[model samples]
Target: DPIFLSSFWQELFTLQGVLLHKSTAYHPQTDGQTEVLNRTLETSLRCFCSDSPHTWATQLPLAEWWYNTTYHSTLKCAPFEVLYGQKPPIHLPYLAGESSNDMVDRSLEAREAVIALLKLHLTRAQQSMRDKANKHRSDRQFMEGDWVYLKL
Candidate 1:
């Protein structure tokens, strides 16, 4: 199952113009931020909804929206806001009175703004991932008289 899933992930990445370079899997650490967020989501939904076990499927999206729109414990800003420098439009109501239909013009401007923000987010995320990977490699590099596990 893992082999098949790995190949699938590789293929998916290849479609995105990325190459799969495999060596050994790195041990995962329990990052506090992620753990806290997961716990918050689970607890919130468990307390809020009790009708179905599939409640997670319904609540997860809302939970993500709330989480991303609210300030992070460490980051000091909402995750989406931090990434994009502003929160994306959550909900809005249309007004009844309009003369020249400025709504269309504003919508186009908003779309262009979103595209620009997305490009910026992608660039930043890529750089962050690259930095983490490089740091991991540097930390794991074997030194003289140091013992390391060989992945055989």
Candidate 2:
């Protein structure tokens, strides 16, 4: 499908800041990151707008903030922090009184949080894989005399 004519497509391309492929019908995995990001965006939108579907326009900014501020397990940093060296300002009205000094502190906190989150996720994933490997090794039923057809 042509995207140049669509403002939605233009905005997507601009925001992504890179050229994206138009994947073949049965092999969408060629654009895996785009697919993953789309899913993430949709999930963020849905979760943020659950209480006000009709007013989701107002929730998009917050959703974007959350997505950009949170650390990505694979990227090793929050999207915004990776791109800008600092997380973008979150639009929370309750924190409107924050000063420039406060922002400096907040950015430091955000960086630490991102690092902690990444470490936690990495630890959990490694532990899960180790557990699965141990279980598989323990459950093996091979016998010394058994003839097994191992596929090469």
Candidate 3:
């Protein structure tokens, strides 16, 4: 709270176009998307820091990078893609005891799998949006002499 209330923090937020809103106690629904992202980031951090815990600070950057590179169904691409106007650069992640060739193959396979998953997610998201939009819509017919708006 003190950090957010500081003049420096206020200026930084203003520069970034971030508007801080007062959150209600025990009301996560008010910021559903933010809450979802927080939960995801927390889960990823927990996974990364489970062994060392104290090494979370070191793992934070990698986790952040991984998150930015991951595909988003709504966006139809990773956040990195939107910001950089291209896909995240491909690289072989370190795998203990694996040779360079094996690592390269694994990296390629992982990317292919991620691409497939992104496609699947996009299809589902589209269907969900269509269903939600259809909820308030109905087929209508107009005929001669049907009531319609007229300019006075």
Q: Say which candidate scores most in lDDT.
A: 3
Decoy 2 TM-score against native: 0.41
lDDT for each candidate structure: 0.62, 0.67, 0.74
Q: Which stretches of candidate 1 lie over 4 Å from their true place?
A: 1-29, 90-152
Query: Lowest summed-lDDT stretch of 10 residues in model 3?
Result: 110-119
| Model 1: per-residue Cα lDDT over 42-70, one tens digit each | 86555434435464565566557766787
Give per-model TM-scores.
0.38, 0.41, 0.44
lDDT of 3 by residue, 72-152 (tens): 999999999999999999855454436468767665564444434545656877999999999998888889999977669
Better of 2 and 3 by lDDT: 3
Estimate the TM-score for candidate 3.
0.44
* Candidate 1 lDDT for residue 82: 82
Ranking by lDDT: 3, 2, 1
What's the candidate order when arranged by decreasing TM-score?
Answer: 3, 2, 1
